[model samples]
Target: MPSEGRTFIEEARRSQIIECAVDVLATEGYARASMARIAQRAGISTGVISYHFGGKQQLLEAVVSEVAKTATDLMMPRILAQTTATGMLRAYFESNLDFMRLHRKPLLALVEVVTYNRGEDDRAPGPYAEQHETSINDVIKLLDRGKSTGEFRDFDSRSMAIAIRGAVDAVPARLLHDPALDLDALAGEFVTLFTLATRRQP
Candidate 1:
């Protein structure tokens, strides 16, 4: 029943609400990011948020999907363009750290979402599961490419992928817990460790 302009405005408003929710979730964890708080932060009515996203769970899902998509879009091209496995792996770590630094709020929210449901059934058909699987698959693909080029050692790419993922996942917690931690230095160390782990030995 709305006009085109009105629909576009509504969509924009919804996007704003989702972003605000992400900020709240990142700063105040998911449990504290209530509908009222998010609406207040977005400068929108709670009813509007409810109308658009149904409830907090749906809004959280939307936020997760948006953040994950943004990260994948930003990193995938850099990863694909690398000419060597080492170069690709370096690109992956650097791009990931840069994304985390630039998009701290949403990235923190993503970490919270991940940690909050760590032991849950990650294989379930949902946005969280899909995002997790996509991340693992991307890393696996990179490892496979590396192995194909003889740049990486002959090992289970899947297990190596999980280890790489674990390192990336651990960074956010370290940063949050110790603001003085040198992330750049840590990233270099991580890249070195990853290279050592996958390097083809003589």
Candidate 2:
């Protein structure tokens, strides 16, 4: 039982450090979000962060995972609640923008990390690349489902998926510039635009 207690405490500490890192990344950008800065934000020594995560890169990776999970948690329910492709598409755009509205900081941190974090081989960060590809594939599958169900017009699923994902992905940068931008308006516009693009004309 003692060991279990220690493990639980460690998990909580790790969560605290990750949350601090997210704030530092969101506010300072990736280039400036050094481990020491994150440590100071967490009110802990850098050694503690290093002990939990081997280095800055790992911590940033964890930040990406955490933010993505949070987004999924918020979005999947909305998406699943819909019964039609059009409804699902609407929910997808609405929920995504709503997430940005509710959790701007974590999304900004994720953008920073994905934009700047590179591996030792100078490759793009693995987590973002993998997650992005999976996102696209998920959209493609959704589009195909609509097609199979005769709910959507005939179009290239992959292309439409890419376009949809691109539209959603562009929001983070826009938010950085226009913090007060009407995301609800934007969300409605996206739903209208993509729904028209994909839905079969009766």
Candidate 3:
């Protein structure tokens, strides 16, 4: 058994490694983010990285889980507080845009993971797929709530969730490829598209 202080220190060190791993992966890509590089970025030794994560894949998974938790932590409260579906949907898009702007590195890593796994079996039990599903479920629940309140048209929430998510994901890709793209203008377009798609008929 470890001393309480030592346990806390170890956990802190592990957290530091996890954070550094994300940075390294984002900057260097998964294929090049070696334990040594991650430790160098963390100001720790390779042994420490190995002690905490056991290997690269484990560290990548932890990074994915951390990124997903961070995204949820940022958005879930606003989502839970909304009394109307339209409000919830607006909050959802705004939160995603805000998150992408503030957390660019993790979002970049997320994009990389999605592109890498584009057509693969995403059903496998892993952090990437798990995070994807969590985000989708959150949107679906909000849509269902909106429909229940007669705020949105009665459409399949799951399909609508996919469309909304696709738009959110595509924004980053477009911005990445074209640095001159105006995100504010794109966001306005997104809002218009979302409203038009979900707006209830008169």
Candidate 4:
């Protein structure tokens, strides 16, 4: 019982520290955000963060995981609610972009972490690369479903998927540069363009 209590408290503390790390990363920039700063923000000792996460890289990974989970949570319900493939595609991108708008700070922090956090080998964000592949595969699945239903024209689904993902992925930088960027307008525009491009001939 005592061990269970300790485990629960440890999890709670780890959650708090990760939350504070996201806040610090967004506000301070990735290069400037240190574990000590995150600890200060969380009102905990730096040793506690180190004990749980080991280092900055691990903490950044945790932040990325949290942000991705949040995005999936926002996107999956909307995607599942749609019966049509076109509807699912729109739901996937629009809801995802909407999630970005709603959770700008955390998403931006994720961008910073992915763009700036380098490993010893100086590779690109390992998690972003993996997640991008997963996203593209999901888009391909939607395209294939639409094709199977005779709703979409027979085109290269992988190309389309990559294009759509590229457009959506570019939004974070745009929003950062122009805070007043209209994401819904962008979302509607992209969905309409793709729908027209992919729809079967009358």
- CA lDDT of every candidate: 0.84, 0.89, 0.78, 0.86
Give a tens-digit lDDT track for model 1, residues 1-202.
4434458777788789988988998999967888999999988889999988888778878888889878878888988898898899999998898788888888888877766643325554544766777788889998998999899889998889999988998888988888677778877998999999999998
Winner by lDDT between candidate 4 and candidate 1: 4
User: Which of the numbered candidates is closest to the native, going by highest lDDT?
Assistant: 2
Local lDDT at 130 for model 1: 69
- Per-candidate TM equals 0.87, 0.92, 0.85, 0.91
Clashes of 3: 0
Give Cα distance to truth, residue 53, candidate 1, Å.
Answer: 1.5
**Which portions of model 4 show Cα errors greater than 4 Å?**
1-6
Clashes of each: 0, 0, 0, 0
lDDT of 4 by residue, 1-202 (tens): 3233468778788789888988988889887788888999999888888898888777877788888889999999999999999899889879988998899989889888777766545754555666778889989999999999999999999999999888888898888899899888999998998899889998
Of the candidates numbered 2 and 4, which has the greater lDDT value?
2
What global local distance difference test value does model 4 have?
A: 0.86
lDDT of 3 by residue, 94-192 (tens): 777777778989887766655553322455554577677877887898888878888889898899999998898788788678866776677677877
Q: Using TM-score as the measure, which candidate wins?
A: 2
Better candidate number, 3 or 4, judged by lDDT: 4
